[model samples]
Target: MSETIRLPHKPDAPLSYQFVPGQGPLSTTHLIVYLNGLIAPQSGWRATIDHLRRRWDEGGSRSANHPALLTYDRYGQGGSARDPADDQHGGSHDIREVVADLHVLAQEIRRTKMIKDADASNEDDGAAAADQVPKPKLIFVANSIGCVIGRFYAQTYPGSTAALLFLDSNIANSDQVSLFPDPDAPGFDPHVLLPPDSTVADLRRTRAGYAAHFHPSAPNPEHLDRRNIISLLPLSDGPPLRGAEPDEGTGPRITVVGHDWATFAEEGLRGSMNVPEGLTNRYVNPPWAAYNEGLARLTSADRARGPVIATGCGHFIQKDDPALVAELTDDLLRNIEADSAA
Candidate 1:
């Protein structure tokens, strides 16, 4: 069942969420929340979430043996009310505001009793279930800009998250200009590197359109300075940063996933922006990998793995590789179980 939550400060913006109880005890204390990319709705997670739910149901319902799952629409996206502060960002909200709302949503998800499907067919009203969710550990499955939002939330509210899965993280330091070749830069030459079909005019036009409307907040409803976030959460080598509170153990479990270069290269053409293959491979791929590398470094060496390239996947890892996404989450679930048993 879908539920609406009203945050105390912003009562005008009600968020809608859909939750399902795993095949565990109704009293389960662990929760998994999936976050959508900036422009996506919660429905973007349907394939992946449905896969995990089926896997849990295989052994039959076990009352709350597994963690409950939650996914919601942020204000100005999906089923949630449009951000009342949309005009404040020139028709969008910034990452800070978005994270602030998530902090409230996280608390509410634990404090309020939300109606959810108990099994494939049964429904339970959450009216009397708040006690079961107190300070419950959270595992966040985040993609693209959602990954940044998750990190900001965990940083502000330490000891709340248990595991994090980052899917093809956005390049936090990109200036919206460096992803492609500069047709106007010094010593620019169209003949040396340009492909046979990719004209100089085509490349220049795309870059202009992208610069005017894409980065930070082009057509997107969320405005964020990609470069600013990295400053807020610098790489491991930059300084000794502390995201988790002191008493909290060695940060949350981190898994980084990057899109396969070939797949993403192909997918890029499917859109209106027909970036030349040579440029995508030469100019776009390297920096994105480096950015994902930085994301992996956000945690300690022992706690992180991969910028695990998702083969046959593009930017939407969950959609392109649903089983892989579920499998990764399942592994994290085991870690949560082990922690709980301890």
Candidate 2:
């Protein structure tokens, strides 16, 4: 039967998770913990699960060995434990805490029995029977900032994660901020990045102009939880910087991105520009520059790994083309296995 697993986040407190075990007997040698993207839990992962189910049936014996899928929200979202401090930029909200939670979930899965067919005539498998089932290899399927958290975990706990499936994500060390005038730019900022005299009108006009261009993969506004989007806002007031701890190790990582929106927009839209004038390069550059640089550092750490490009998508690849995400996830998990075998 499906269940919930709680892990200690702060002392005397626990983080709650919804654990829906896959139907059928446990047959896979790997377990995939899918991390939800920026907004909230219960968003953007159904397509992924459906894709996996179809593949499991189609691929026959080969797919029968596919990993079990586990998905959970971060501490603040969904049923997870709340963080006392709402400080966006603090270590509490840092990628590390997210990583630690995944670790706890992984350990809990290791201890549990396979969710045997609910209709079976058999009783509990018992400890002896449970011991016979092999330990499931762990893989993390992450998106957006979730990818960043997974990357940190793999680097720190290298042996634990079999692989990472990064969908439309930034994997580099976000060290420095640069200016890019367009507000629609992936990492663009308006207020601090722009000049002092830049009016509120400038900010509103910039956001509106960009909003026209901000076509996420899934256009449904319901998919986003705007109330909890504080995490996506920049942690630091200024352009965010890449902060690397002393011992980041080389770990296996992979990235998948949808078609380049900026290039597409430049080509598709006609010449009349609606964005505010005098928006300096300074304002536009910092976030993307920092995030892109961080992505570079991550990819460089392991050349054999890749930043795989997915076709035809805006920011939310999970919503736009979940089939692509699933296909890529399969390949990524296989690669992780291959690396381990090698």
Q: Which candidate leads in lDDT?
A: 1
Which window of ten consecutive residues has the lowest lDDT sum in model 1? 236-245
Per-residue alpha-carbon lDDT of candidate 2 for residues 1-342, written as tens digits (9 for 90 to 100): 224555544543445454445433333356777777656464468787788668767864336445567776566766655543334443244455556666776766656534232223245643244455555556667776666666567655645555667665542332212123444566756565666646556655554544443323212222222222233333312121121221123444444343344532333233244333334233432344344334434433442334444556544667767888877776665555455455
Q: What is the C-alpha RMSD of each candidate to the true structure, in Å?
A: 4.3, 9.1
Model 2 poorest ten-residue lDDT run: 238-247
Tell me, by TM-score, which candidate is best. 1
The TM-score values for the models, in the order shown, are: 0.84, 0.61
User: What lDDT tens digits, residue by residue, belong to model 1 across residues 1-342?
Assistant: 578888987897788898775545423456788988876789989899878777776752332377778899988777788877676756666677888888777677665533233222335543344343356566789998888777777776777777789998767666555577787889878897576657778778667756765565355543443445656655522221132233155667788999999988787666677766666676678888987887777666676777899999998999899989988888777765665556
In model 2, how large is the Cα lDDT of residue 238? 16
The segments of candidate 2 whose C-alpha lies over 4 angstroms from its true place after superposition are 1-3, 8-28, 84-92, 113-126, 129-136, 170-172, 175-177, 181-253, 262-306, 336-342
Cα error of candidate 1 at position 201, Å: 2.7
